[model samples]
Target: MIPGMFDYFAPSTLEEATRLLEQHGPDAKLLAGGHSLIPLMKLRLAAPRVLVDLNGVAGLAGIEERDGHLRIGAMTRHAQLEASELISDRYPLIADAAAVIADPLVRNRGTIGGSLAHADPAGDLASVMTALRAELVVVGPRRERTIPIDDFLVGLFTTALEPNEVLSEVRVPSPNGGSGGAYVKLERKVGDFATVAIAVQLTVRDGTCDEAGIALTSVGPTNLRARQAEDSLRGGSLDEQSLRAAADLAAQEAQPAADLRGSEEYKRDMVRVLTLRALRRALERATR
Candidate 1:
């Protein structure tokens, strides 16, 4: 597939990128890993007249833990996240999703910022970010601001970012003792998007849930937090019945669409099953 002819600009600095975007406005698309934009462009589903490539923009890749939070540059690739010892040790939920984002080649080329900004409902990272209550730092020509994951994701292929803004960084808090997180996905093939997936972060203390975060993927117009399910798990001993109840609530909150993957009911069922599995796995990895 080939994309339409367009003017290409590979800006080496963020300020330059922003300037290009501000100048081009809605006619321009920022190219990160090019995984999402390129595909859409090739399909003619997107036709930006200007391509503002961010690939050459330095200082937008890497993972660093600082000030009790792990800060990830937007240009960081999935392969890097999957290979990072620091990410594996501190935020396995990220590493877990990174490992399965696509095959090795795709993983090497996919960037977290691109995926998040694309805001595909079926993508795994949005749910994981929501589950962790992560924040994104967005920069524009006028100002900079932080957006919570829930607020950042508005709908399918939509976000709060202005056309002139760029997502610069992702920030996640350090997990305390007894805190554990994991992501579980069900895909039809090795590189397919998830049919139904779940991301969970749970904190336990004295055999009871101290905190819980649950989010579902490919289950609604946008990836969403399962707040009722999360509330159901809090202050309870994570036993068979409690887990089942919480998992069931997650399914109830889901609004999955029927596609070739399966029926809506089947997807809801998968949500229940995967939610339970993810919670169990996260619990087993719980620290303290």
Candidate 2:
């Protein structure tokens, strides 16, 4: 299907891009890697009057550590994250999510900002970032602001970003000593969207869980931060009993609907099983 007609503008600066969006208002859209938008446009589900291409925008494509967090530029490609030594060494959860986001073609062309902004419930990074409690930075005309990942994702296909704003970066807290995380996904095949996916990060000190983050994907309107599950693990030993209790809470927290993937009950059970597996894996990594 051919996309509807639209004017295209390649802005070399983010300010200019935002200015174009401000001028064009709701009729304009920002073009990142175009993996998600282009398909919608082709199907005539979206037809913007103008496209502000962000590829030419400078200073929006890098991964680096600053202060106490890892700053990931909005335009950074999934393949870049998967291949990054910094992510591999310290943020293995990010590496795991990056590696499973579709095939190489999609990974090479898709941008992290685009994925998060699209806000698909099944998006891998959504669950991973939620578990990390990442922050999102957005730039608008003459201003910038940061939003927590939890607040940034408002609903399915919706975000806190204004139409005239550009998501500029993602900031994840640097893992401390004794901290580790894991991403566990269940899919029918390679490159398939997850039926049920779980992301877990744990910080253990002296054999006791000091902190924990548990998040789920493809189970609700948005990536769910399993707060109940996280709370269950804090200050507890990372033993089979505690892990089982937390897993049960996570399963209860999931809101999977019956679909071709499986019955709702089946997905909820998978959540319990995966949560247990991920917690153990995170604990092992944290203790090592």
Reference-based TM-score of each model: 0.98, 0.99
**Clash pairs of candidate 2?**
none
Hey, what RMSD does candidate 1 come out at? 1.0
> lDDT (0-100) at residue 228 of candidate 1?
99
> At residue 264, what lDDT does model 2 achieve?
95
Which candidate comes out best when scored by lDDT?
2
How many clashing residue pairs appear in each of the predictions shown? 1, 0
lDDT of 2 by residue, 1-288 (tens): 899999999999988999999999999999999999999999999999899998999999999999999999999999999999999999988998899999999999999999999999999998999999999999999799999999999998999999999999999999879999999999999999999999999999888899999999999999999999999999988889999999999999999989999999999999999999999888888988
Q: Give the TM-score comparing model 2 with the true structure, all chains together.
A: 0.99
* Candidate 2, poorest ten consecutive residues by summed lDDT: 279-288
Candidate 1, run of 10 with poorest lDDT: 279-288
lDDT of each: 0.93, 0.95
